[model samples]
Target: MPLLFIQRALMIAAVVSGLSACSLRSSPPSFTASGFVADQGVMRVWRIDDGQQRPLVLMSVYSPYSGPGTISTLYEYQNGVLYQIKRTDADGDRDSIQLRFTVNGTVSFMQRQLATQRQKLSNDDIALYQYQARRILEVSDALNVGRVRLLQGHWQQGEVKLCNGEVVKPGFDKQAENWIARRTTNNHQPVSLAWLDGPEGRELLLVANDDFCRWEPTKDTL
Candidate 1:
C-alpha cells in the first residue's frame, strides 16, 4: 500500500479510538494544532476552543508541493456556530473569498475577489463554502481528540526554535530527521520546518527556506 494511504488509515483508527477517550476528559485544552495530507499538498490547522470543546476559531494553511499555489483559510465561530469564513490564495490572481453567516445559519455577507475584479458568489457557491467550513471543523475535532499536533519552527544546528523562542529537539523518526539534516546541510539562510506529531508517530510536512513566522497567525491576530 502507498504511504499516504497507510497514514490515512492510521489517522482514521486514531480518530475512532479517540472518540471514547475524549469523552472521559473533564477539561480539554483551549488551543490545539493538527494537520493532514490532502490530495497534492499538506494542510496545517490551528484551532482555538472554548473550555467546553467548542471551537472559537480555526485556521488552516495548505501548501501544495506542486500545483496552483498555497491557500489559507480562516473560520470563526460565535457561540459554537460558524459565523465567518475567509480564504485566500497565494496565486498571481490573488483569489479570495469572505462569507459571514447569521446566527440562524443564513448568509449575511459574501464577497469574492480575483485580482482586480470583484464577483458575487452564487447560492451554490455559498452552500459549498458552508459545507467546507463544517467539514473542516469536524476534521479538526477528530485530530485534536487523537492527540495530533502540528508544530512549526526555525531550523538551526539540528534544533528547532519555535515561535515563542523555545529551542528543543522534536521526536521525529530517523527518516524525518535525516531529511531535515540533508535539507539544512550547508544552507546559510534560515529554513522553516513544519511537521505533524501524532499518536502513530511524527511525520514531516514541510521544509522550506521561507520565513513562516511572518505570515503565521497568532492568538491576537486569529
Candidate 2:
C-alpha cells in the first residue's frame, strides 16, 4: 500500500506542478561567468541621468534581484515610458508591447498587439507603419526577437540613446572581462553578457546581458 501511495503522490505532483517526472531531473540553464541562473534570469535597470542605481532586470548578471524567480526579461523605453518588454521562463518566451502603463510599474508575461496601418508608398507598393507609430513601432519591431545572454557566445553590439539623448555604442569592456573571468574562476558567476558604456562616458555603463534596458531621459534631456 505504501508503494502504491508513493507512486500516486508522484503522479499527482507532476500534474500539480505541470512538469513530468522525467523533466524534474533536467536542470535549468544558468550562466556561470555572467551570473545568469536559469531560474533567476532578470533585467537590471538604471537611470543613467540620475546618480541612483536602480536594477530593474534580474538578467543583467550585474542587476540587483527582482521580479518572479526564474523569469528572464528585457526592457526598452521611449520618452520615459516602458512600452516594450520581452521575457522568458519555464513555460517559454514572450513579448509585451504595452500602450498603457503605470508609473514605475512592471508586468509579467502578457503581450499586446501593435495597431499598425498599411501605407501606400506607391501605386504598386505598400509598407507597414509608414505613418502610424512610425517613431517607435518600427524601431521596436526591428529589434531581435530574443537575446540569450552574456555567455551565450553571440554577443550583440549596438547604439543606445541614453537618458540624456546621447548616443553611445555599448558593448564589452576591460573591467567586465576581468570581472567575468574572476567570477568564472571562483564559480560565483556563470552567465555571459556584454558590458556597455553609458552616455556619461567610460565611467558609467548600460549592461546588455539580460535583454534591453530602458533609458529614462529627464525632461531637459529630451
Candidate 3:
C-alpha cells in the first residue's frame, strides 16, 4: 500500500484510541516528541500543550537522508487554534514563509522570502500553507496517541546520556548499537543519537558527532 494511505489509516486508529483514553484519563502529556517517515525524509516533531491537553506549540524538523537540506517549521496556537506558522529552509536559497491567522482562520499576515528577495504569497499559496498546517497537526496528534516518541541523547560507552541529563541504556537493537559504536570509534569524539520509539520498534534517525543539544529547542524557546 502507499505510504500516504498507511499514514492516514494509522491516524484514524490513533484518533479512536486517543478519544477512548481521553474519556478515562485527564489529559495527555504537557510536552511530547514524536516523528514519522515521509516520502522525502524523516520528520521529527516536538509539541507543547497546556496542562489541559490544548496544544500551545508544535515544531517539526525535516531532514533528508540525501539530496535535500533540512527544513524546520513552527506552528503556534492560541486558544487551541493555529495562530502563526513559520517555515525555514537551511539551503543556500534560505526560503521562508510566515503566516499569521486570525481567530476565524483568515490570514492576517503573510510573508515569503526567497534568497534575498521578499515576495507576497498568492491566494493559492496561502491556502496551501493553511492546509499543510492542519495536516501536520493531525499527523502530530496521531503520532502522539500512537505512542511514537523521539529521543535524543549523547552516546557514551554502551549507554546514552539523554537531553534531560539522565543516563540510561537505550533500547536500540544490536545492529544500531554497533553502528553507533563504529561511528564513535571513527570520529574519536562524543556522538549524538536521535531515535524514534514506538510500539512497533525503535528506528535510528540521526547519528552525528555534533552537539544535538546546541540546536535543540527548549520550552522557553517555544
Candidate 4:
C-alpha cells in the first residue's frame, strides 16, 4: 500500500484514540482519565485541561486493540505536569512522540520519534520496511494535540529529514531495535527519532519535535 495512505490511517487513529478507558487496556484496577494501569505498571494519565484525582493502586490491564505496526497513544502526568505521547508502527517499524504541557495548557516540552522497520519476507531472503514519518503539534492552547505528515517514504529508498534536522537516510542506521538517521540528502526538501520504555515493553515514539530543533516543512514531490 502507498505510505501516504498508511500514514493518514495512523493520523486518524490518534484522534480516535481517546476512547472510553474501559475499551483500552479494558480491565484495569483504575482506568480513569487521571491515571490507569498497564501490564502491572501504573501510568498516570493527566487531563490536559485540568488536574484532579486520587492515588491509584497497580493492577493488570488488557489491551483490546492490537494491530501490528499500527498507531496508539498514551497520556501521563509527572510532578503535576501533563504530557501526551503517541506511538505509530508500520510494517515492522514502531515510533512515538511525547508532549509535556503546563497546568493551564502551555506546551513545555516535545519529543518525537522518526523510525522505520525491516522485516524478512517468508518467501525471500531479503527484507523490506514501511516508513511513516509524521508530525504531532500542540493545539487548542496546548490543551490537545494533532498529527500530520512531515515526510514519508517506504521501500528501501525511503528518506526524510526529521523536525530536529536529523536525516533518516534511505538505509542508514539499520539495526534490530530500530533505524537511525546517518545521512542527509538535503534534497531542497525536509521532514524527521526516539525510543520509549512503556509499561508493557519498549516502544518507539512518534509526532512533532519543536523543542530541540526548528526545521520547518516545505512542499516537495515524493
Candidate 5:
C-alpha cells in the first residue's frame, strides 16, 4: 500500500483507540477543534483554538519494559498552533499528559513523567505554563511554494546555469520541471509565472533581478 494510505490508517486507529473507553452514563469528550486535555495520570488533551470543546492535542506517556524509557512525543497542529500530547508508560500502567504553552511568543507542547505521583505539578505551576497558541499559519503561508530555479537552467548533458551565466553541472530529473518553475519564480519575486524552454518542451522563466520578464522555452528540432 502507499505510504500515505498507511499513515492515514494509523491515524484513524489511534483516534478510535483513544475514544474507545466510556461508560453509558458518561459522554465521550467532544472535540470542537484540535486541543489537548490533562487527565488523571492517564492522558491529556489540549485545545489550541478558542470556543472549541474537544481535544486538539492528545498525549499519552508509556514505558513498557523493566527499565525506564519513552516511546514517542506526538505533535498535532491545530488552529495554526502546534500542540503536544505526551504519554508516559512505567511499570505495567501508563500515564499520559497533554499541554499547550506559550513561550517567546511561540506556542509549544510538552509532556514529562515523574518517578512518583507526588512529582506531579501543582496547580500554580500548571497555570504558569498555561497559555494560548500563537499563529503558525504565517510559516505555512510563507512556504506554500515548494522550490525555484533562478534564471533558466539547462539540463543539457547534466549541466545547468542561469540564463546568460556560466554553466554549472547539476542533477537531471524528468519530474522536476514544475518544481523548478515554482521555486524560481517565487524566489525572483515575480508577480506572475515565468516561462522557459524545458528539457521536454517550452516553459516559462522569471527574472526579477533584471527585466522582471518571463522566459519562454521551445524545443530545438534538427
Candidate 6:
C-alpha cells in the first residue's frame, strides 16, 4: 500500500510541474542585456531583413558602468498606431513614449517619425536649427548622461558658432578639436555648429549641440 501511495504522489507532482512550465512558456518575452532586463507587456515587436521576419529589437538601455547605452527598436504598425514600447531600469517604470531596440553592439540612437519634420533645403538654416534639433534629440534619448561627451573627428580648419553665439574660427592649430556644439538658444544666443568632411570633401558632416543620431527604418514584420 505504501508503494502505491508513493506512485500516486509522483504522478501528481509530474502533472504540476508540467503545468508550471506551460504557464511560463506562455508569458511575455523579456528584454535582457548585460546588467539590465526589461519586462514588456502586450506589445509585439518584430525584426525583418530581406523579406524575412523575426522579433524586432524589444529592449535597450545604457549599461550601468559604461556611457549611456543607445538601443534602437522597430515596431509593428497596427491600425496606424506605432506599437513599439520602451522599458528601462532608470525610471523604475516602463516608458510608453520612447521605445528603443538594439541594432548593433552597445550602440543605439534615437529615431523620429520622418513624417513629422519638414526636410528643409537651406544649408545655413540646416546648419543652425536642424543640426541642433537632431543633436538635442540624441541627448534626450540617452539614458544616464545629462551632458554627453563629443568626439568630433577632425576634418579641416573652419569657422564655427559657439554656444554663446560667438563665431570661433579654428586657426592653424589642429589640437583645438575639442569643443562642444550648443544645441539650444539662450537669450537670443545662436546655437553652435561645426563642419566636418563628407563624401570626398564635397559634402560636410555638421556636428552641433543636441542629439543628432542615425535612425534606420525596419523592413519586416514579425
Candidate 1 deviant stretches above 4 angstroms: 1-23
Total clashes for model 2: 21
Q: Estimate the TM-score of every prediction.
A: 0.86, 0.22, 0.83, 0.24, 0.20, 0.17
lDDT of 1 by residue, 81-198 (tens): 9999999987747899999999999988999998889999999889877876766677777777777778889987778998768897886788888888877888888999888876
Per-prediction RMSD in angstroms? 3.9, 19.0, 3.6, 19.3, 22.2, 24.3
Candidate 1, number of clashes: 0
The regions of model 5 sitting more than 4 angstroms off are 1-70, 90-97, 102-115, 118-222
Scanning candidate 5 in windows of ten residues, the lowest lDDT window is: 139-148
Please provide, for model 3 over 1-222, each residue's C-alpha lDDT reduced to its tens digit, 9 standing for 90 to 100: 023524554565466456545434444577888776665566778999986677899998877755557788899999889999999996757899999999999999999999779999999888877777777787777667667778888988877898888998877888887877778875778788889876667888777776877777767776
Cα-based lDDT for every prediction: 0.78, 0.29, 0.77, 0.29, 0.31, 0.27
**How would you encode candidate 5's per-residue C-alpha lDDT over 1-222 as one tens digit per residue?**
012322333443344334433322333232211111111111111122234422244322222212333233334545534544333343334554556545332335444445555345555544443321111122111111111112343333334543455575444344555555445553633322223222223323221232312232211200
* Ten-residue region with minimum lDDT total, candidate 1: 1-10
**Candidate 3, superposed: residue stretches over 4 Å from native:** 1-26
- Between the candidate structures 2 and 5, which one is better when assessed by TM-score? 2
Encode model 6's per-residue lDDT on 1-222: one tens digit a residue.
012322333443344344344343332222211111122211111222122212223222222112332333223222222234432333232222333224321213332222345232243522332332222222222211111112122222355433233454534233323432222324233323223221112112233332222221222212
Best by TM-score: 1
Give the Cα-based TM-score of candidate 3 against the true structure: 0.83
Off by over 4 Å in 6: 1-158, 161-188, 194-196, 202-222
Clashing pairs in 1: none
CA lDDT, candidate 3, residue 10: 57
- Count of backbone clashes, every candidate in sequence: 0, 21, 0, 13, 44, 17
Worst 10 residues of 3 by lDDT: 1-10
Instruction: Answer with 2 or 3, whichever has the higher TM-score.
Output: 3
